[model samples]
Target: MSRPMNDPRFAPLNLALEEALSRGLGSGFALGVRTQGGERFQTCLGLAQRVPTPEGLTPKHRFDLASLTKVLLTTPAVLALAAAGKLDLDDPLATHLPDVYQYDPNHPVRRVTLRQCLTHTSGLPAVEPIYTWGEGKARLEALVLQKDWAFGESVYSDINFILLGIVIERLTGQSLAALAEEAGFAVTPGPSLAVATEACSWRGRMVKGEVHDENAFALGGIAGHAGLFGTLDAVLNRADALVFGAALPPAARAAMLEKQTDDRALGWQIRHLNWSGGGLSSARSVGHTGFTGTGVWADTERGITWALLGNRVHPTRHTDVRAHHQFRQRIGNLVQGIFAN
Candidate 1:
């Protein structure tokens, strides 16, 4: 029988996480670990806010989930569409986004494919100041469409996933949020008691229940690169599905998990030394970290899924992430011990 609760050995994991929180590594965090054999654990620690009023972190408070949006929303949509024969990874951008490609002065846009974007080999710059560069979504997107492509190494550009989101939107004719729902996920659907994130000058206040990425904000808070928000359970459920063959078809899952770039899967990130997933994950383990102190990692070989969500940027974006990284490593070590036979 599967133990749906924590074992005493799990105490060290919780203590390390709580100590990190107490040290202000983040304002608060929610963590969950699950294995196929039914071993499970979850815990929350710290405050959701500290300046104006204190709100305790709970299992239910949604996190910003910055870049995890790629895995949680865009990637699955791409794989599901591929599985359903609705789109092809190798299809030219012109096939779905003809107007944007044809009018762009940069002809490279025409040659870019969903596959390159997914794999971050499309040569899109790692990031562009589109939020400040333009006035509206059209202008911002057009700016991206006109940028040059190098098409060689893995660049890990937000622009790549942003384009993927656009592709998904154009092909589906539905908002990314709607498609996320269709895929059994949710974005920042509405105002809620979400964990607070950066207190940005752009938004000019404490950011809560809204995205923290300025670019995604400029794009109406539903872009491929960021702008997802969800509870710990929502994230773990998605991670579990992805790892255990529930969310994606076998081929799609394989393709997504396959190392397209040295350290990157289709939309998820593969483990590397000192990565947030830490050293215990197998090479096949896949995960992504968010800027707002959130991440999800799955070790398929071990049937383990771990989610850590927090408002590390609660009052500002200047928080150093090294502590968060170390916390993950400690938790990873503890998990390794628990799963050791």
Candidate 2:
């Protein structure tokens, strides 16, 4: 709302995005950029909906935020627990959830530490049809953890955060949604400003005002890997916190940024070439992406926080998601150029 989505200052970036939209990238785009100086710029354009009922995208619209939930909601909760002395990063999953692999008391998976999960090095498969496994969070969780996980190098897995979510719930006696609400992340099942997502074949309707991830929806719409809805402000708030470190204890902040892999820190991705944070980002910067065509990047050196939220999955998720990543990387590069000048 700071400036119209059609603001000319964003014209250069929007020109590229508009081309993507024209070629069926998504219905619309919304972006927010803020600097440590408190400078703010926001722009949104295109339609928020293209079927049933049409609506235009706005800066105020709440995006599905998809896997961004892992960083914005789940990761912070884990950090809080660590800061509170409820847990340690090196502790195995069994330390918090003793029943994770109760089927095998000596299962190596029980030794998968929190740090490994935070860095996506837990050797878990990248994904699974969790919803198809069964109903109820407890059932899905047990199924997820009890699966015969193959061991290997680091691979980003939704399973990692899903387990982390369960761990947090077990530790705090709170649901992920409750933690999100308490954290003031602006997440909700149905915000009045919600943007439409895919017309799910399984659900037999256009997905809007609810979770888009099938597994998340099946898990009751509030899991560790997905099912967070928020506006640009929520993402920016997270980016802001990353830059300022004002809200985290010194130990927690340090632990959050500790490198656990060549390209990853605790819950964030270290900037690398061809990644969504763009090739131009400083080495110290970290960022994350969501399956809903949403992402947030923070340039710690520049003290900038940027969030790009869009409904690229709207009407369907079969669109060119790779192109959406291109949009994110290109826009990230452009944002860097603007501030560098």
Candidate 3:
């Protein structure tokens, strides 16, 4: 399914990524584009890290795949578990994660369903500083279930995936790292070879080859929401799986890409107005982005999957978010042009 290097079609993509590099989207990036027909190509450019001795980027450089873990790992893991008859998507989270506020059966946390969590309608806050509050991963995670914060309409929450992680572990009796490794993630990339993301004030050093999310870092460097590091191929292969891999039941795979709620699917977000996937994204397209400036989008209708892996947070994350979207949109539309015929 691999194409020869230097395909003429990739020239425009190279120029686009080069322009992004010039604009400081990231010190470096690795992008992969593949068609369902098995045509594949990539463009890797810029420096992986700007601080310390400079290192040039290469296709082998693993990037910290931040929130991509939700779709590329957690959602698929949940589907696989369901296919294996370990759990049901409609089952309450407490059905799998029994310790989720177990003391009070009447707790609202007990009523949240796995499907609701997958669809980001679980009534949990978008985020909480569980990392700052607790001493241990277990204690911090337990706070998510027990914390009596005001819950309103459903919101995207890292806690949802954290709970999903707990459920997966409880059901499989295996660590997430082990499962992630099996799922084709390079969970523990060497710091020397991994792309650097930030000059973290908390960690007192440049964050490279380690997770940047404070909560995922606090959770012993593995969580359902983040802490995944992977190669560009790994990201693309998973995107390929979501679109066509038979590893999950057809119904489960369909659910992952279809609109499960509003514009959101199980974990991926379907293309919508003004979405970063761009104007060219068809209704069958789904994608997700990461805090570390990584993204993957696949269009079933177009038979194309593309990923952009970058260290946009390097040095700092205090940049205009809109600019990132504009860049992604520009590239998404351009990628679509490849199959316009």
Candidate 4:
């Protein structure tokens, strides 16, 4: 059921998004939806940035995907590698990435596995300015390994994904960007296609077409935790692929989506009350959110995928998470209504 341009059933979605843009929840926003019957709909509105001149956003515009990189890039690569028999999820990180574990042979980090890292149960701190430790990769890796490793409780930690990226690179001999491209990300965007993000004071300008996470930025803009970028359509395409069996084989997909710990699937978050997908999400729903106001939610059971890409941190890197959460839920509900049978 292709929604016509004049479809009144979609008016609520349009109205809500337009109001959100007018209220400055984001300078620009794009929404993409896919239904169980393989129908797709997309809309783009507002400016990519209000400052430094107002540039309108379109479906082609690339937005800094922030933490979406974890699921979109790192997790898929690991699953692909696992499916190929290149590595096992439970293999100790030291087995695949000995260089990153060079600092302590007996360290608990030595025994940390890909599963722990992907599940955020590796006991790594929530964050560490690894870039400030030294200027190079070795220094960062050494510093990370030198930290005490905690296990048991699942805490979302960027360091876990950082090490996962290193593991992927070590095993595949390719950069995360290359692997992401192979996994179906739009790596390079033409001039008009880049959505503006935060006006970084450190970089002395607005961040457009570049990653916004400082740790990822310092790590040369490609880390396991952040730095992937994509357009609305591209992100939705990947989501469709992921849900429809193109991204992962049956066994791998099932394993990845299974609840491991802390209400999280391997790399995705199971939809819960008041989360990004809000009340619109069913128990079968899985999704992930990015710091720069980007997110994707898919219900394999219902055959629906909803994606939102917004420069929520534009003009600055601050916004109320509660507001965004509410906005996401509203959008989710509206999209569900439009596509409901």
Best by lDDT: 3
Q: Could you tell me how far off, in angstroms, the CA of residue 11 lies in candidate 4 after the best superposition? A: 1.2
TM-score of each: 0.92, 0.94, 0.96, 0.93
Residue pairs in collision within model 1: none
lDDT of 4: 0.80
Better of 1 and 3 by lDDT: 3
Candidate 2 residue-wise lDDT, 273-305, digit = tens = 678988888888888998878999888778777
Compute the lDDT of residue 9 as modeled in candidate 1.
79
Name the lDDT of candidate 2: 0.82
lDDT tens per residue, model 4, 182-263: 7666443433668887788877877777777877777766789998888777788887787675688988888888988657
Q: Point out the worst 10-residue segment of candidate 3 by lDDT.
A: 1-10
Model 2 regions lying over 4 Å from their true place: 1-9, 186-188
**Candidate 3's TM-score:** 0.96
206-261: candidate 3 lDDT, tens digit per residue = 88888889889888788989989998988998789777777578988987777777
Full candidate order by TM-score, most accurate first: 3, 2, 4, 1
lDDT of 2 at 141: 82
In model 2, the clashing pairs are 5-44
Clashes of 2: 1
Model 1 ranges with Cα > 4 A deviation: 1-7, 104-106, 147-153, 189-191
lDDT for position 76 in model 3: 91
For each candidate, how many residue pairs have backbone atoms clashing (under 3 Å)?
0, 1, 0, 0
| Deviating ranges (above 4 Å) for candidate 3 | 1-5
